[model samples]
Target: MALKVLSALDVAKIQLYHFKAIIVAGMGLFTDAYDLFCIPPIIKLIGRIYYDDKSAPTAVVSNLVAIALLGTVIGQLVFGRLGDQIGRRRVYGLSLSIMVLSSIACGFSICRTRNCVLVSLGFFRFLLGVGIGGDYPLSATIMSEFANKKTRGAFIAAVFSMQGFGILASSVVTMVVSTIFDATSDAPEGHTPDEADISWRLILMLGGVPAALTYYWRMMMPETARYTALVEQNVVQAAMDMKKVLDVPMSQIAEDSPLPSSPPPTYPLLSKRFFRRHGRDLFSCAASWFLVDIVFYSSNLFQSQIYHRFIKDHDPNKNGYQLAFRVARFQAILAICSTIPGYWVTVYFIDRIGRVRIQMIGFFFMAMVYFAIGIPYKFYWHNHINDGFLVLYGLTFFFSNFGPNTTTFIVPAELFPARFRSTCHGISGAVGKVGAIIGTVGFIWASKNQKKDEKPNPERMTVALVLLGVVCLVGLSVTYFFTRETMGRSLEDNENEDDD
Candidate 1:
C-alpha cells in the first residue's frame, strides 16, 4: 500500500461512516457546551440557595465560571499531545469517561456546609472542563481526517455545530426543570430554596447523559487512516481501516503486498523547520480563536445578567424559580433564533465560502454589531427599543458561529500535518480557553462590582461591550493578515505532506 495514494480518502464519496463519525465526534462537543454554558442561567439560583443575601459572592461566582476553564486548559495540552504521541482513538474515550464521572459528581455535590458544597462543585466542574477540553482537538482532527476534501470544512464545522445544540439543550433542560419544580411547590410564589437546589443539580448532572450514551460509539471508531499511515508509518493498516470504513475496493491493500517508501520524516514539534513552516499559521489560528472566545464566552456566560441589565429592566420582585425560568426561556429563545442557525449556516457554506473569508466577514460584522449596541445602549434601553437592541445583539452571536468560531476549529485541523494536527489544534484551543477564562472573569467581575454599588449601570456594560468590539477588530486584523484559505484542498496539499 502506497501512502501517497491516500487520496482514496480525500476523494471518497459521502457515506454512512462519515455521518457516523460526525455524530460520535460531535456528541463530545454537545456535552462540552451543555456543561459550560448551563452555568449562567443557574448561577443566580446557586447564589440564592447557597448564600445569606440571595447573592453569590463575586469571588465565588468568578471561580465557579473560570475554574473548569482552567482544567480545560490542562486537558487540552495533555490529551492533545497524547493524541499525537499515542493515537486519537486511545484517549478519546478516556476524556468522555472523565466528563461523565465529573458531571455526576457536580450534581451530587451535597455537603453539610456551604463552603464544602461549593468546593465540591468547583472541583468536579474543573474535572468536567478537562474532559471538554480534550474533545476540541480529538473531534476536529478526527472529522477532518475522515472527510472528503470537497466537504471537509463542512464536516468539521458540523461537528462543532453540535455545540450550538448542546447550548440549546442546556437552556431547554433548565427551563423544563425549573417549570416542574415551580408547579410542584406548595407556595404560591413557587420559588422555594429546596426546589432551586433540586433543579440545578438535575440540570448539571443530565449533561453527562449524552456523553455517557455516546461512549460506546466513540470507542468503536477506528484510528483515522491519516494518523495510522503518516504518523505511524503503517500504510497497510491504514488501507485496511479505510477499506473497512469507506467500503471502497481501491482502498483494500493486499496483506502480502510490499509497503511503499515512507513520506518525508516529520519535523519535531518545536524544531526550527516546523516553526518556519507553520509558526504563522499556528499564531493566526491561536490568536483568532483567542479573540473570539473573549467576546463569545463573556457574552454567553453573562447573557442572563445582560438581558436584565441592558436589554430589559430587572424585576426586583421576581426571584428564585420565577427568575430562573425567565432567564432560561430567554436563553432558549436566543439559541433557537440565532445561535443554532448561525452554526448550521456556516456548516453549509464553509467549504464554499472558505474559512478565511467567512471568518473575516464574521469578525467584521461582529465588531460593527458590538459598536452599534455599546455606543448607544442607553438610547435603546431608555427609549424602550428593546426589540431593536435584541436584533443587533443577536447578530453578534449569528456572526460568531458563521464566522470565526467554526473556522478556528476547522483551520487548525487543516493547516498542520497529520502527525502534529491534534497537538497543534489542542494548543490553539487551549489558548482560546485562556481567552475564555479572561473574558468570563473580567465580565463577571465588572458585573459584580456594579451590583455591589446597588445600582444597575448600563454605562458600565456599554464599556464592556465597547472593549469587546475593539477585541473583535483585532481578531479581524489577525485573520486578514495571517490565516490562509483551506477550501477544496487535501490535508496533504494544505501542509505540503507530499513535498515533506
Candidate 2:
C-alpha cells in the first residue's frame, strides 16, 4: 500500500487558532480543578454548620470526596467512547452543562436533616464530577489533535496547566470569602446560621461560572480534522475544517487527489490488536497517573488537616470561618509559591527535554522529597517545625506537577490512534481517579485511626508519605520501561508506528 500523505493539519504551522483552542480547552480544566479542589474548605464549613462539630465524620467526608470521583470514572468511560463514536465537539458541551447546573445545585443543598443534606449534596457533586471527568479526555484529545508536533507537548501541557490556575483560584476564592465573612460577622460562639454556611455556598457556585462562559465557544468549535479524516473518512470535510483553522486553502489539494472509497476500520479497544500494540502504553499512562494522584489528591485535598497538625497552637477558640481562612491562606501560599510554577516549568521544558525524561525526573525527585519529609516526620512534628514541613511539602507539589502529573495526562492523548484517543485518555483518567479515591478515603481512615492527643501522632502521616514515595519510584520505573517518546513527531507518525 502507498504510504498515506500527511493531512494539512498534521504539518500545519502553529498559529492563532492553536492558541484559541488551547484557551477554550484549557478553560474546561480550569473549571475542573476549581470544582474539585473547592470542595475541601466547603466540607469543613458543612461540618461546622450541620454537625456543630469542627470536623465532619471521616466516613462522611470521604464519601463526599470519593463519590464525585466515582462519577468521574463513569463519565470518563462513557463520554470518552461517545466522543469517539459521535464526535469530539458534539459531546464536549454536555459535560460542562452538567457541571454548571450541578454546581449550582450543590451550592443550594439544603434539607431539614443532616443526612438529607449530605444525600443531596453528594448527588449533585456526583453529577458535577461526571462533567469534570468528561473534560479530561475531551480537552486533552482536542488540544493534542489541534497542536503541531513541534510543540505538541507544550500545547497539551498548557491545557493541563490550567489545573494549577484552578487550584490557585480555589485557594484565593476560599481565602477571600472566608476573610470577608469572618470580618463582617461578630456572632457569638456556637451561633447558628454562621457566615461559613453562606461562604461555602458562594464558593461552590463560583465554580460554575467559568464553565458557563466557555460553553458557547465549545459548541462553536469545528470537529477536529484528524477525527473527521482518520475516523470518519471524510477527507473533504477534514480538509475544509483545516483550511479554516490553519487559514490555508485546501481546495486545490483536494481536487488533485480524489477521496478514498472508504476509511479504514477502527479497532475495538478490547481487541487483541489493541492489546498487542497499546497495552503497555495504556498501562504506563494509567499507572503513572494512578501513582501521581495517590499522593497528589491526598496531599492537596487533605492539606488542611496536615496543616492543622503541623501548627502546634491552632486556637480552638477560633470560629470555623477563621479556621477555614487559615487553611486557605496556607494553601494559597503553597499554590502561588510552588504548584503553579511547577506546571509552567513542565510547559517550558516538556517540548525540549521530552515527556519520558521529565516524567522520570519528576517521579525520582518526588520520591526523594517524600522520603525526606516522611522519614523525619517525628522531628518535624515534635519540634513544631511548621515552616520546614511547609517547604518540603511544597516541593512535592512542585515535582508532582512537573513530573507524572502533567506527563501522564499528555501521553495518553498522544499515544493512541485518533479513533481511540479520547476513549483511552478517559480510561487512563478513570484509573487515576481510582487511585485518587483510594488515597482520599484511605487517608481519612488512616488519619482518623491515629490516636488523638494535644500533639498529633506523626507515625500515621509518616507511613503514608513514605508509601507515596515508594509509589513514585514505581511510577518512575513504569515510565522508563513502557513508554515511548513522541517529541517532534506527527500524530499520524506516532499512530502509524503501532500498525507496523
Candidate 3:
C-alpha cells in the first residue's frame, strides 16, 4: 500500500528537541544577510563623513562591497572541499567560530584612512564571508539531512528564508541607530560622528553580535544522522541517534539503509565519483547565485539607485536622514512581510509537488520579471512611470524566495549522496559567488557615467535586466531538463545509482 500523507507527516515532522536544529540553520542565513546588508548603509555614512571631494566614488566603494564576496568565492571553494572531506557538523562549528572572531575585529578597528579602513574591513569581511560561505553548504546540507522527507523543503526553505529577516533587520538597525543619534541634543563635544553620529562604524558593530550569538546556540546542536550513518555504517546507531535528536521512533524514520562509508580517514567529496555526479549542479548553483547577486546586490548597496531617484524626482528638498529612514523602512517591511507565506507554501507542497516543477516555475517567473522590467524601460527611459515598476520589482524578489532559489539551494544538499553533499554544494555555492563577484564588479561598471547626464540611466538598468533574463532562461532550462526531483527519495538511492 502507498504511504498516506498522515504517515509521511509522522515520519517527517520534527520533535521539540529538533527545533534547535531549525534555529541553528536559520541563524547562519540570518547572519549572512545581515552582514551583506550592513555594508551599504555603512558606505553611505563613510561617504558623507570623510570624503572632502564630494561623494565616495562608486568604483572604490563597490570594490569594498565586492571584496568580501571575493573572499567568499575562495571560502566556498575551500570549505566545500573540506565539508565533503570532513564531517558537516565539524565544519559548521568551525565556521561559526571564524565569524565571531572576524566580526569582533571589525567592531574594534580604529583606522582613519578610507582606503586603509576599506582594506581592513575587507580583510575582516572576507573572513566573515568565509565563515558565512562555509555555512551555506554546511548548514543547508545539514538541514536537509536532519529534516524529514515530507517536510524537507519547508524546513530547508524556512532556514534559508530567514535571510529575508536578516536583510530586513539590517535596515531597521540602522534606522534605530540613526534615530537615537539624532535624538541627542548637544553634539556631546569632541565625539563627532563621521556621518551625523551614527557613522559606518556603528553599522559594522551591529552586524557582529548576531554571529557571536550563533556560536552559543550551535553548541547545543548535534551532528546530522545521515553524516553519522555514512561515517560509521551503523544504521541502527544512526536511527537511534536521529531519534534522540529528532525525538522520534526508529520505525518513524522512512528511508533505506545508509550507504557504505567512503574510504576511512576522509570524507567522500574528496573521492572522484563524488564530483562526477554533482559537478554540473555545483557550477549551475554558483552561477545562478552570482547572476542573482549582480542585480540584487547592486540595488541593495546603492540605495542611491532607487532612493536617490525618489529624492531627485519628488522630494528635492527632503533631508537626507529623513529620506534614508523612509527608504529603509519601506524596503525592510516589503522584504519581511512577503517571505513567510511565499516560502511556507513551497514547504507545504514540495513533497506533493516535484522539485523540478517548483524550480521551473520560479525560473520562468524570474525570466519574466526581468523581461517585464526591460519592457517598461522602452516606454519610459530614465523616467519614473508609476508605482507599478516598484511593485513588479518586489514581486520578482518574491519569486526569488518563493521556490526556485529556495529549492535550488536545497537540491544539491538532498540529491548528492551523503559523502559529496557538502563538497558538491560548496562548489556549487562558490560558482554562485563567482557569478556574484562578476555581478558586483560588473554592476558598477555598467552604472558608470558614460555621459555627462549622470541621470542614473535607466537604459543601463534595462540592459542589466536583459542579462538576468538570459541567465534565468538558461537556469530554467538546466533545472527543468537536467535536474531530477530529490523529494521523498532516500540518500542511499543516490549512492546505489552512483554504483550503477
Best by lDDT: 1
Runs of candidate 2 with Cα error greater than 4 angstroms are: 1-6, 189-195, 251-255, 300-305, 309-314, 379-382, 450-456, 497-499
lDDT of every model, 2 decimals: 0.82, 0.80, 0.65
| Model 3 per-residue lDDT at 327 | 53
Model 1 C-alpha lDDT per residue in residues 295-352, reported as the tens digit of each score: 9977743354455555332444555666667677777788899999999999989988
Model 1: CA > 4 A from native = 1-5, 188-191, 250-257, 260-266, 300-306, 309-319, 378-385, 448-456, 494-500
Q: Name the lDDT of candidate 2.
A: 0.80
Residue-by-residue lDDT tens digits, candidate 2, 266-301:
667779988888888888888888888888877742
Better-scoring candidate (TM-score), 2 or 3? 2
**Candidate that beats the other on lDDT, 2 or 3, i.e. the better one:** 2
Q: Tell me each candidate's TM-score.
A: 0.93, 0.93, 0.86
Q: Which run of 10 residues does model 3 get worst, by summed lDDT?
A: 1-10
Candidate 3 regions with alpha-carbon error over 4 angstroms = 1-12, 185-198, 234-240, 249-276, 279-291, 298-303, 311-324, 337-341, 378-381, 452-454
Instruction: Give per-residue lDDT, candidate 1, residue 254.
Output: 35
Q: Candidate 2: how large is its RMSD?
A: 2.4
Residue 135 miss distance in model 3 (angstroms): 0.7
lDDT of 1: 0.82
